[model samples]
Target: MASRSVLGDIRRDLEAYVGSKIRLRANKGRKKIVEREGVLEGTYPNIFTVRLSEADSVRRVSYSYADLLTETVELVVCTASGKETKFEAHSR
Candidate 1:
């Protein structure tokens, strides 16, 4: 229950970054790391989506907030003034 509360709070904070540019880094097992820059498209009760585009193709990836809580995903929001706000999983 506590973990859910923490995730809820984190989700609310992330909601403010919608439509903003953000850097997303995730682990794909076997020490592989994938990183991408995209706009925080939208946030739902259980998951959020990020829209990424390369060349002429665009894609949207959805990840659950629980993924953040488990350190599966890391997010960094880039601000207009060159400041970055990072969000990572925290030990509970």
Candidate 2:
């Protein structure tokens, strides 16, 4: 199947309301194991800005995988020695 641009869509959606408030999920840490809900501060083509609810700190997150799939997404966390660690996603 052809991969759709999911990340691109997110960017466009965010652009529609540049200064408005919105809810977003962000992954913290290099492993992306920690997820948190926060307010959407800004959005770029493949990047999103958020102020973390916990620490009230602003952070940038890349959403380049949005176009991968409609219901599922995958992230490659590591690849070494012919082994790989990936994150599988199911979106509503």
Candidate 3:
């Protein structure tokens, strides 16, 4: 299972990937935005899915790899209601 800290790392990496102004959502309720590129890669079992884009100011970025069986990263954004919104980063 992927640890919660992994999400933090991904968030931190987003800032670097998209530059230094990328805003990532902190947990739920609070939407964090940054003007940066989001590059994410992972192994089997542990995938990431991006669910929400906070305020819609962020441009959706996509990429693909030839290693993992799953194409997209599964990022679940927790909402203020303590619910999760699941999203997948797949190649089209």
Q: What is the lDDT of residue 19 in candidate 3?
A: 21
Using all chains and alpha carbons, the TM-scores for the candidates as numbered come to 0.88, 0.39, 0.23
lDDT of each: 0.88, 0.45, 0.33
Expressed as tens digits, the lDDT of each residue in 2-80 for candidate 3 is: 3445544444433332221222322222453333323233222233322224466644443222211142223333344
Off by over 4 Å in 2: 1-7, 17-32, 55-62, 65-92
Query: In candidate 1, what are the lDDT values of residues 1-92, reduced to their tens digit?
Result: 34777878878988888999999998889999999999999999889999998879999999988888877899999999999989765645
lDDT of 2 at 36: 46
Tell me the lDDT of model 2 at 84.
37
TM-score of 1: 0.88
C-alpha-based local distance difference test score of model 3 = 0.33
Candidate 3, residue 39: Cα displacement in angstroms equals: 11
Full candidate order by TM-score, most accurate first: 1, 2, 3
lDDT of 2 by residue, 26-61 (tens): 344475544444444676655555554567556644
lDDT of model 1, residue 3 = 71
Better of 2 and 3 by lDDT: 2
Q: Report residue 62 deviation for candidate 3 (angstroms).
A: 9.7
Model 1: which ten-residue window has the lowest total lDDT?
A: 1-10
